[model samples]
Target: MTSGSGVWITLEGGDGSGKTTQSDLLADWLTEAGRTVVRTREPGGSEVGQLIRDIVLHHRGDIAPRAEALLYAADRAHHVATVVRPALARGEVVLQDRYLDSSVAYQGAGRVLDGDEIRNLSLWAAEGALPDLTVLLDLDPESARVRLDAADKPFDRLEAEKTEFHARVRDSYLALAEAEPERFLVLDASASPEAIAAQIRDRVATLVG
Candidate 1:
């Protein structure tokens, strides 16, 4: 948990699980409730992070799994130091779309790297910062793929991975939530956006109050 005057909330899940949509709604809800909300995401939250995002997510060639993991850790280090930590110090609610969980799920599980090592790398990079709450938008890979297809956009490197890869990622996320149930609100991502948002708001209300 963060030792600051603010609340830090992170959303985790597989691709096309509506994390972005729910993140937007939660930010709006928090802002309307008179909280100073700082909405951000990993891999691109900072200017330097954006360059790393392009290399890791959109670059045309195969990137070594270890190299990809390091890039994400680098971005995470800078993002937390430059954006997240400062906002929390100011007593703001930081609604982040992803965090260490992404690295663990993608590079660790999907890329078949060691999840513990990946998590430790990120934890060290971020100086051991952890969110107060993590909302896991759990969804089946098949449904996620269908949603991605409907978007009609080019898939990034991770998004273009096989169904088995996504299944592993989902499983890893569930394991993580189970390991830290006190800090996680695991919800079915297949539900209506409004319904999901409502549940998230309820969870956040307790923290913010």
Candidate 2:
């Protein structure tokens, strides 16, 4: 809203791809370099968003694909209205852990919804908003599953899906990056945390130059 003053940077990846960890590191580096930074995550960056997030992430029963996608979109609209847009208006760099890309990957590709449908939903939900730069953390499906297993937590319904679903999500992400090369940075996530963090730093330096 404040005329090219703030940046929206979104981090995208499969579960266990270290998006949470890397997002934090990137925020810290940005703050250290004297940028006003806001760190937040999807499905729950606002009060309403959090409520919707719980329904989407932890619901014990089966939710239809379209139903699930709408819930996610609702959460994202709330998040953008309350959290993301405000920070950007104040000239703060918004470092989001996930954004519309998740919807396209999980709901569109993974759930067998048409990609165009998801894209339209994204545009509607986001009100034409998008990240200035999206960093996709690429990792093999097996490696990601191993990392998720190491997390030692009960897997959610979505997380508990077959490996094929996750593979589709990964492929969708790759396609997204290929389609929007100028706005996306694909990083190899199957690396040491520190190394991944370093990769993020170098990218920020180039993009924010």
Which candidate number has the best TM-score?
A: 1
Candidate 1: C-alpha lDDT:
0.94
Q: Model 1 over residues 26-126: C-alpha lDDT tens digits?
A: 88888888999888888899899999999999999999999999999999999999999999988999999899998999999999999999999999999
The residue pairs found clashing in candidate 2 are none
Q: List candidate 2 stretches off by more than 4 Å.
A: 1-4
Global lDDT for candidate 2? 0.89
Tell me each candidate's TM-score. 0.98, 0.96
Can you list the residue pairs that collide in candidate 1? none
lDDT minimum window of 10 residues, candidate 1: 1-10
Per-candidate Cα lDDT values, in order, are 0.94, 0.89
Locate the minimum summed-lDDT window of 10 residues in model 2: 1-10
